[model samples]
Target: MASIVDEDNKKLYIFDEFFRKGMLNNELAQMIKDKGYSKEVIIADSAERKSIDEIKKLGVPRIKPAKKGHGSIMTGIQKVNQYEIIVHPNCTNIQDELDNYSYKKDKVTGEYLNSPIDSYNHGLDALRMSIQSVKRKARILTVKL
Candidate 1:
């Protein structure tokens, strides 16, 4: 996914998202190039070093690993929540992920937990990386959308 930092408004615009299942590194690289995102900075899962290296070797430029640590998810959720996120009309995958990715709940009490549910977060995971990128640059403060 590609996002823009509207620093003036402290808002995040999810401009683009690419979601594909079961793709090889070369295929992913080709898709990035075909989409004209070969030069754009791609923030990916830190756990996928092999895949990321393979993609880099295959020629997509500026692919970076996202920050990962204890509480990173909760922290990311908080950070991203500070900005008003606006999704482009075509980024349906992102929209769906955001819509379904909710906080975990107590099964018996039905109370919202601090952690998010494990399901429905493929796009949101990427979104968190983008949020981390923005925070690393200190581009803005707070989220609401």
Candidate 2:
């Protein structure tokens, strides 16, 4: 899973369900810890989907329930306000912007390379916010409502 938080203090956090067990969990936790972040400051937002053991293994601070028993568009947006940085997928519209960046294509067939099938809109939004945070320039495609 992932970690989400609320407020500038970064005291509140939301973590995903897969914080423990497999190598993935360890890696996820290690990534944050490696950056010198405490598990207490990180919360698990999707704990219901995963086992409690997995949640504890991550050692994050708080666990919040997912909205409407599942992740919804509104909840996803709400998550943005909770944390300083949000790393998610970019929506379909974002593809147009990313399209400008050349990706590897089939050299032999001369076919255009395909973008990731997964949604990167959220990640793009997060990245955009990060750029703005650093006083970098970026195109604003969507409203922050």
- Compute the lDDT of residue 92 as modeled in candidate 2: 31
- lDDT per residue, candidate 2, 3-93, as tens digits? 3333445332222222122445456545545544533323233323463235346763332223333434334445443445432343333
Cα displacement (angstroms), candidate 1, residue 104, comes to 1.9
TM-score of each: 0.86, 0.33
Report the alpha-carbon TM-score of model 1 versus the true structure: 0.86
Q: Lowest summed-lDDT stretch of 10 residues in model 2?
A: 136-145
List clash counts for every candidate, in order.
8, 18
Extract clashing residue pairs from model 1.
81-143, 82-142, 82-143, 83-142, 83-143, 83-144, 84-144, 84-145
Q: Write the per-residue lDDT of candidate 1 for residues 1-145, one digit (tens) a residue.
A: 6777775577888777777778777888887788777777777777888888888888876776787788898888888888898989998988988888888789999999898887788778777766776643333211111
RMSD of each: 4.7, 12.6
TM-score of 2: 0.33
Which portions of model 2 show Cα errors greater than 4 Å?
1-23, 39-48, 51-55, 63-65, 68-71, 75-118, 122-145
